[model samples]
Target: MPVARGTKAQSTKQPRASKAPSVTENVPPQKDEGCQAKRSPSSPQGGPKKRSAFGDITNAHKNQAVTGKKEGVKAPTNKATRAPTAPTVAKNNEINLKKSLKKTPPAEVPVEHEKDSVPEEPVQQVPVVEDIDKEQLGDPYANAEYAKEIFDYMREREDKFLLPDYMEKQPDISRDMRAILVDWMVEVQENFELNHETLYLAVKLVDHYLVEVASMRDKLQLIGSTAVLIASKFEERCPPCVDDFLYICDDAYKREELIAMETSILRTLNFDINIPIPYRFLRRFAKCARASMETLTLARFLCEMTLQEYDYVRERPSKLAASSLLLALIMKNLGGWTPTLEYYSGYCAQDLHPLVKRLNFLLTYQPCDKLKAVRTKYSHRVFFEVAKMTPMDMMKLEEKLKS
Candidate 1:
C-alpha cells in the first residue's frame, strides 16, 4: 500500500509538471492563473492545500526572491533553481530583518517589566509657608516664585563680600577721596542714562578693589572710571565704550591706563564682582511693604546717600536696605516697619534702629561740598526730588521705633 501511495504522488507531480507549460500557453495572461500554475508542482496531489495568509505572504516573498522580480511576476518553474535559491533568499531575508531590527528603536517596555525595572522613590514633601509672590503669578518678569529664595541667596552672599574699615590701611587715600569717587560715579551713571544698578555695582567694585589694593591720589580717578566701566559691562545692556569712559574723565587717564586699571581691579578681586548692594535690598523690601513709588524713591535716595559714607560700608546690604526703607517709612509718616517688611527683610524694627539713626544723621548733617553729585542727581524732579525732602525728626523716629 505504501509503495502504491508513493507511486500515486510521483505520477500526480509528473503530470502537473508536464501540463504546466501547456496550461500557461492555453490560459489567459492573468496573474492568478500564473501563480496557481507555479504553486501546483509544490503540492503532492491534484490540487494545492489551502494556505494561511502568512504562508501566502512568505511564499510570495520567496517567489519574488527566486525570480529577482516583484510580487505578481512569474516564478521560475525549475525545481533545481527554486530549491537552492529559496534557502539563500530566506537566509538573506533573515539577516536583513535582524539588521533592520537592530537599527529600529526599542519597543515600549511591558508594564510588568517596567514596574520591576526601577524602584519608585518616595516623593519629598516640602513645608508650606507664606508665598509673597502668590498675586504675581501672571507676571513672569517679577520672578515671584523665586523672589524669596533669591533674596535669601543674596543675604548669604553678603558675608563673602563684606567690607571692613580699610581706610587705615591706605596712607595716601582717605575716606573723603573714596566718597568723592563714588559721588562722581553717581553723576556718570546719570549722565550716561545707565541703570541705578550700574552706579551701585560700581561703588561696590571700587570698595572691594580698594580693600585689597593701595592706590595713589592721582590714580584714584582712573580706578573709579575703570570700576564704572566694569560695572557697566556687568549691569548695562549697552555699556559705554572705553573711549566714552576716557572722555568722561576729560582725558585725565589714557585709554590704556583705564583698561589696565580694569584688569588690575578684576584680578585683585579674583573676578568675583557680584557684590550685594543696599539698592537691591531696598527695592525688594519696599515691595514687601507695598510702598508707594514716592516712598520707594525716598528709600532709594537714602540708600544712594549711604554710598558716599565710609561709615556705612561695613553694614550688610540687606540691613542697610531695610534700615533705609524703615527710615523712609517714618519720614513719610507711613508708620514704622511692618511685619511684612520684617519677615522679608529679615530685620525687625529694633535691628534697624541704630542704622536708621545714623542714616538720619547723614541726611540731616550733610557736610561734604565736593561730594554733591548724589544729592544733585536726586534733587531733580525726575527723581521726585526725594533728596530735597526733610529728614524725619530724630525724636519721632525714635518714638516710632520704640512703638
Candidate 2:
C-alpha cells in the first residue's frame, strides 16, 4: 500500500489468530460435538466426533496413569457444585415472622340472643271483652233506638245554625299542624304530670275558641297554646309555672306574649271562668253511681277523651264527658252504668247506648289511625272507660248550644 512521506510504514504480517476467542467459540461447539458423538452413526458429522470421543477416553486413561506414577494417586471424578445454605439466625427470624402472622383464637357466642337477632315475638293478641257481658249499660239502643233521631238532628243543626261560611271553610289548623299540636300537648302532659281532663279541656278550649273566633289572619297556634295555659291554671292544683310552660314551649312564645294571650282568651269567653267543663259533671255522676275510684277515674278519662272527637260536638260537653268517664270506669272493672247515672245527671241516659255505639262505630268499625295519636299520646284514660250516649241527645244539646 502507498504511504505519505511523513507517516510510518504499515506492517505486512497479520497478528496470529487468538486461541482464547477460538476456545470461546468452540465451547458450545465442544458440547455439540460431544452430543453428536453420542448420536447414531447416521449423522453427517458423526465420524469425527466419534473418533474424538475415543481419543478423549485414551487421553483420560493416559493422564490417570501419569498421575499414579507421579504421586501414587488416581484423578478425581467431575461433580456439580452445591449452593450455600442460609445462616441459622436469618432462618430462625423468618420462621418467627410466619408464626406472628398466624391468627389467634376467638371468644364465646351469646346464649341469650338479642331481640334484633331473631324475628320479634308476634304481638300478643289481646282477647276482647264484649261490651254486653262486661257492661251493665248494655248496648247503645238497649233502652231506645236513637241513631236516626240523632243523625237527623245533626243534619238540621249543621244546616240551620253552624254558619254556612264556617262549615265550608277549612280552618287555619291544618291536619299536620293539629298533629304537631297534639304531640306537643302530650309532651306537656307527660312532663308536667297534668291531669288528662285538664289537658283535654285545654285542647278543646283552644279548638272551640279557634272555631268560634279565629280568622285566616289569626295565628291558630298561638290560640291553641294560650288556651292550654289557661286550662292548666283551671284544672291543676299546683299549676305548671309560666317559666315551665315557656320551657315546654322551648321559648317559642315570649312571657309577654303568653300574658297577652291569656288576656285575649279571657276577653273572648267574656271572662266567663265557669266554662261548665265536662269533668265537673263526670265526677258528680261517677260519685252517684257508687262506682269505684278506678271506675270514676276511667270515666273521667273517657269524658276528657271526648273532647278530641269531632262527632261529639253535638253532645253536651257535660253529658259526653260523663258518659266517657263512665265508659272508662267500666273498662277499669269498675261499676257499670245505672239509669240514675243518666237520669239524675240530666244526661238523657236512655240514649247513652246509641251514642256510645255511634262512637264505637266511629272508633272501632273502621281504622282508628287518627285517634291513635290520642291513645298513644294521652294516658288512654278515656278510651278504655267511655259510656254509650244516643246521637239524638247529642244533637239536641249541640243545637241548643249553637242556637
Candidate No. with top TM-score:
1
lDDT of 1 by residue, 265-357 (tens): 999999988888888888888777789999999899888888888988898999998888888888888888666777788787888899999
lDDT of 1: 0.73
Worst 10 residues of 2 by lDDT: 103-112
| Candidate 2 TM-score to native | 0.47
Model 1 Cα shift for residue 51 (angstroms): 72
TM-score of each: 0.67, 0.47
Q: How many clashing residue pairs are found in candidate 2? A: 23
State how far residue 128 of model 1 sits from its true place (Å).
Answer: 14
Which pairs of residues have clashing backbones in candidate 1? none
Which parts of model 1 have CA positions greater than 4 angstroms off?
Answer: 1-130
